[model samples]
Target: MPQSIHFISIGGSAMHNLALALHQQGYTVTGSDETIYEPSRTRLEKQNLLPAQTGWFPEKIHTGLDAVIAGMHARKDNPELIKALELGLPIYSYPEFIYQLSRQKQRVVIAGSHGKTTIVAMILHVLKHYNREFDFWVGDPIEEFDTTVRLSSTAPLIIIEGDEYASSPIDSRPKFLAFQPHIALISGIAWDHINLYPTWDEYVDQFESLAEAMPKAGILIFDESDDMLDVIGQKERDDITKIPYLAHPSEIVKGETFLITKQGKRVSTKLFGQHNMKNIAGAITVCDRIGITEDMFYEAIPTFTGVSKRLEKIAESTDRTVFRDFAHSPAKVEATTEAVKQQYPDKKLLAVVELQSIDNTNKSFLDKYKETTDAADQVAIFIHPGSADSGEQITTSDIQKAFQKPSLHVFTDSAALQNYLLQERDASHIFLFMSSETFGGLDLSNLAPKLI
Candidate 1:
């Protein structure tokens, strides 16, 4: 019989995907979570992998269980976690298990403060077009793929969006540290997760460590557009092959974007923006290293719509449009807002961002937003005053002053902000909602239609 494996907190995107992957691998999988959200809850139920109910139970821990996978959401003192510790069963963090499975496969680890998901999705999309059999684990759900995570015993390659966040409670190392890929790509370095790495230098140190972990003969791909990455990538690393890429050659003709290839052929893409162009270049470099030719990369890119929530268009009318993006970091916020502004240069841009993540909630990180929202014709910064329950010391006024943009508005309440948008938004405007987390209780989708 296959071994029995249980997950302590299996409701998360990564956790749920891992649980499903294990089940597909012939393991008898059971999992418990305090709560499960849509898509995950539905997907789990479809596979008969949903827990009997929500909340952890110590009784679920047993000697018959061969392994336990604990999610980062679960604390070290969680009842299931404590029981698993007492039982002395083999426990693996989600990334640890991914590393174990990909040990024999040629792994490509994509790391960055932003754009990792898009780059990985681009690579996966091109590979799929070529009918190349490879497994991947991305952070967001790709429309073309059924699941965010996939694993196969016979697949020769594995692609992973290697995040720098801590793996689990017991394991404080960044999630990417476990992979130690044969070929690695660092998109760029930007200070983020102030709660984790309190200082910018400390945050950069993680990427340095990732660089050092590369095998002697492995390759390191980096973005030359980022001076910080340029400095780090150019440093004397004797063993690794370093390849640098800037924004791919492209042109905007009659408001349409097209790639200018080495052969002088112009190929158009469904996606837009300079950031996405850079993302495409990074993915193309990886594909070239993996034996895919330049022609194939360009040929496959036209069909790539993009990963969900990176820059998803929610609703559109004849004269107005609403876009929702998962952009919370200072760098991401700047890129996302700038992308929208550039796309609809003539349209009045109103960018609304929720300071939901731990870093954005911290007072020290507020200054990073300085001029980040300058591209927007009007900017609204929303913060759930109660988001930082730990009392790390931050105020909406501090964020307002930090941005230094005259048009910036700060909101502690979502209702007032919603009302402001409804009343102020006009037919010739583009509304962009940016956040890594959901707006306090507002559904951007439901609100999109009313805007029109």
Candidate 2:
């Protein structure tokens, strides 16, 4: 364990959690972020870990620090980063430091464009169920755990949610590349991060690179359903153990989802969706290899409602339910929308979305979402056309033409969309808000009550 560490941008969700985890492990943890937000600010303050002041102070980066963990939000030329570089201090990007900590442990890295968080969360949920000792790093908050990152000396394994996004400002490599795992699971690969991985082939090449990074004897578990993953799984690799899994056979009866195991055992769960079933299969395979039994996996999974924002239920009435999900990417959007509609075939489905990232709004990426909206009965897209916005040129006609949904509603202002939805609340329906961004800055949690 690192005795003393300084975080360049601690206010970030994962970064703050890692800092808190290290602090709990008896390490000296200090962090600096120009601006800190709600949960991060409050959590850090609770632990007395909040910095005396905000912003970078090069003087704070001294020789006594054991190392520096840089967050993605931090710049290449941050004053503290510059000072750390000047002092010849060992600087590790967020992912790099996580890798360093778990190098000796059996590293299980779940990597893909989508479903990574769910798969990782499922694995962790099961591991904890049977009292199996392990540390984990997941991207989103889970109800099973207080923090997203955990480190313990007694744990013999570590599970990581491997993201393909760039590690940090100075580190150009993808974050997942840092975690050379003993067990690697690629849930599914879809072309994403158009701004960074400009071409379809280039986007896929990142997954191939991840496969190449694994040790010869390492076990690679992948989604056989994915064409790209199928190709990767079939490619010659005599030394590595390759395992392929598809969606667990299941049936949805009366709004309930049940997973049918290989032995024909029906496992009931609160989770819904074919994609979630596939995520379960991927997680089950990973856990099975790590010595968890089919029964144990089944027993633990039903307890996991879901990770935060992945098809999470925010508010509900007798007939209407409102859900908010972190699904900005095309694949995620299609799966989440389809899942909700599948679960409630009799109910009216309204899928609201906000394309937050620049990559999500790119014209080249528009084709990816062509058929995604077709799953919903109605589609409402909210894009704030302002100074920092992407897809400013995109119009309702373009979206209508692309999605083939002539009734698609496009709103540049959140207020108008809110008003429209509030007015339309007389109908009992399942309102699904799907976005990596908040619905044009509308407080959906607060609004959900009124809609109900």
Candidate 3:
């Protein structure tokens, strides 16, 4: 008999993907969410896993369920959670369950404040390129992978994008703490998730704890360019193997990015930017530890166009191109904006950002974004209109002063922001829309109808 699994909040991106993965693995999956959004709703309905009704029902949480996968979206006092507890059903946070599922496999955890998703995608791409059988759980959707999370009894290794965020509302430990990886990589550390970890030192300590979680004789690989990571990587650990990597040697030729191998061989890639190169270097080091050759890596990596929304080209013409990225944090915003500017030095780059998270409007957080967007020829900031009443008073003057770009544009209305983008659009410009949300319900499909 297939195991019965109930999900408390299946509408979340990761939660829905995990539910789908378990269903594909032959489990009887059932879930409830207060609300379900597009893509996740459609995907769940397609699998016949969507609940007949929205919202929770304690009656559904019976003793018949083998386990309950709790998502962060549910409150601590959720009735379903209380029912599951009273019924004595095993309840596992998404990360806790993932750790249990892949406990037997050689876990490779890619962790850092930034670039973890991209690094995981690159590793998965190279492994798929070689036709290697493996399981993975990444935060974003990959090109060829049907789902963001996958598990199979046959696969011997599991590659996980180790987020440092809290596992669940009830569970305060960072998600990576549960992985206990056999091989671990930390890209870099910059303070983020201020709502959870209020101070930078507290956030950095999470990475430190993750580093300590590694089993003796485990392999630790890290980015040497980051001072904090360098200090962490260099710390003496007699039982572990340490490998440090820097950005792969590369040069731009005629507007195309290429990797310069130590053997003097040049390999071209569809993905550009220094941050991406650094991600590839970390992936290659992991591949090397697992017995993949340089020839295989170079041959396979060129075909990797990168995962969706990591500088994804939404629309393009002879002169102008529109891109979308999930870069809400200060470091990511800078890296993504710089990448576009460096790639098309001759073209004008317009960077549009949406401050959806409350942290984005925090006065102290604003200081981190001071000069991050300076690379763009012009910059625009949009605050979600619905959030205007939330009392996070971030004004146009606040944005202009924070960015220190006197000419910066700011908007609180979605329609006004869309019109502004259209007005600023030109044949010689590359439009980059960067946000973790959909720019507060601004439909990109209908954006710039003339340009597309």
TM-scores of all candidate predictions against the true structure: 0.95, 0.96, 0.95
Q: Which 10-residue window of candidate 1 scores lowest in summed lDDT?
A: 387-396
Tens digit per residue, CA lDDT, model 1, 1-452: 22798999999989999889888889899999999998899989999999988998999999999889999999999999999999898888888888888888999999998899999999999899989999999988889998899998899999999999999989988899888799999999988877788888989989988888888999999999899898888888878899999998888765467899998999988667788888988999999999898998988998888878888888988788888898988888999999888878888999999988777777667788899999999988888867662676567667778888898888878898888889877733889999877777887877899887
Q: In lDDT terms, how accurate is model 2?
A: 0.87
lDDT of 2 by residue, 124-212 (tens): 88888888889999998888889999888778999999888899888888888898899899988888787788898888988898888
Q: Candidate 3 residues 1-452, lDDT tens each? A: 22899999999999999999998899999999999998999999999988899999999899899999889999989999999999989888899999999988989999998788888888888888778889999988887888999899889999999888888867878898878899999998888688878898898899888777778999999999999889888898879898999998898998899999999899999788888889889989998877788889999988888878898988887778889999988888999999999999998888998877877777668878889999998888988654532465677777787889765888888889888888887633889989998877889878845444
Q: Write down the TM-score for model 2.
A: 0.96
Off by over 4 Å in 3: 386-392
lDDT of 1 at 156: 97
Q: How good is model 3 by TM-score?
A: 0.95
